[model samples]
Target: MSAADAELRQAFAQLQAQMVETQQRVSALEPQMAGLQRAQLHADATLQQLALAGAGGGGGGGGAENRAYQPVGRAFLLQPLPELKAAAADRRSNADAKLEALKTMKDYLERTLKNSENNLREMVQQRKEQASS
Candidate 1:
């Protein structure tokens, strides 16, 4: 093959590798995004339940005594209910931010893949024309 053809082939291989890596990254992000969404839903439900319980006056203000147990590895730690709620809110916010970042990355990768495919096609066409000539 000519030097130009070899260079084009090398570039195509690199782009193919990058496309596979991007696909893997997107797959990894999918699960993380789903987990975050599930956590956010759980947090929202917990907050709603707390609100309802408080509005119903169920236990006079003993809700303050409510302790939330947080899991740490194989153990659990006792935290106040309000503090747990705050932590859950923070987790939800962080998950949302990460999800947004992943989405941006996915978009960029898709665009790059499209551009690379177009370039590869153009290079192949040029090579064919050169061979014919």
Candidate 2:
């Protein structure tokens, strides 16, 4: 009986540790999710600006086509409106993909945490029942 109780205690401690680890992982992903969301929004705005520029340049003879001043590593380059739009779209898609992956990971971790808690509770209940008997 004592050995069984000791085993149960050890299991409970392990479950608690697992829950804590899952919680930490979920917490760490939150900031990354926020940053990705912000980047996506920025990309969206850039795309919108590019669209407006393209539209305005279309109605008038503005050097044949519109161009966007995009920043490079340490300099600005005049890029075609189409190229800028494509780049912005790519950024948005990448951010969205990363955000989705992080969200899925966080969800899985949360589920694991809940399962651990449930297992811990069940163990305690069983221990109580055994003691009562």
After TM-score superposition, the amount by which residue 104's alpha carbon in candidate 2 deviates from its true location, in angstroms, is 1.5
Candidate 1 local Cα displacement, residue 41, angstroms: 1.4
For candidate 1, which ten residues in a row score worst on lDDT?
A: 51-60
What would the C-alpha RMSD of candidate 2 be, to one decimal place?
Answer: 2.0
The regions of model 2 sitting more than 4 angstroms off are 58-64
**Among all candidates shown, the one with the greatest lDDT:** 2
What lDDT tens digits, residue by residue, belong to model 1 across residues 36-130? 78877887887776555545544556677676677789999987777777877787788788878877877887787778778778877887898
Error of 1 at 63 (Å): 6.1
What TM-score does prediction 1 earn? 0.75
State how far residue 81 of model 2 sits from its true place (Å): 0.9
lDDT of 1: 0.76
What does the lDDT read for residue 2 in candidate 2? Answer: 87
- Could you report the Cα RMSD, in angstroms, for every candidate shown? 2.8, 2.0
Instruction: List clashing residue pairs in candidate 2.
Output: none
